[model samples]
Target: MKTVEQLLQAKGHKVISIAPEKSVFDAMQSMAEYNTGALLVMRDDELVGILTERDFSRKSYLLNKPVKDIQVKEIMTRHVAYVGLNDTNENCMALITELRIRHLPVIDKDKVIGILSIGDLVKDVISEHQFVIEQLERYIYDTPEI
Candidate 1:
């Protein structure tokens, strides 16, 4: 089981964040620039909430509120689901599945370290499975055939 620490190391721990007071347009632009689906809504280094594409589509666009007119705090998801650096990839996958969320902030000792997306979890699982399959094949070929 690979820990989030390893995952972050492989994926690079670059957390794209935006201030809670920032305009929705700003958050969206940051998301675009980062090529991410969500952004950590921070307030003076504290993880206040998460602003996601769903929040934008559902809250702002649907409400017909212009991005410049609204703030991230208004549309950001307040109840965030988070993970720790020591957490296993399986645990992260389970949490994301059960919570039905795309992104989770990775924390270590109350400090925000990185963020994990559903895409990241899926990629990790696929890589792990591929490695296991290759190992099994090597072992089978190295042994006598039945």
Candidate 2:
């Protein structure tokens, strides 16, 4: 039930981005440096696309060229799927499931704020379930001879 705004608050909005003109090799280096699976492709201040490990693996094969010779904009997924701060974690999960996407960029006030991965949503769901389980256990234990 948590909103993307709350989730970002908890996780911190540290989005790693790459310029569209950057080489895929550079993008890969950044991803490795940050230990991230994806990067937002930015054109100046505008978000143009998203580059992910999947894109690199799938498209690079089609190009049959070295990553150093490939541009991020050439292989990156141009049709980006994004979310908003008001969106709920559940809703984002649903969208990700339907779209078969692993990462979603969160936008607020016409600006990109953060990104959420499938791992993030799954972790939140597990945490929420744990909280509910703990609360139910507490209620049951505190109540005497129901």
The regions of model 1 sitting more than 4 angstroms off are none
Query: What local distance difference test score does each model get?
Result: 0.91, 0.94
RMSD of 1: 1.3
**Predicted structure 2: lDDT:** 0.94
Model 1, 75: alpha-carbon shift in Å?
0.4
Give a tens-digit lDDT track for model 1, residues 29-68.
Answer: 8888878899999887789999999989888876577789
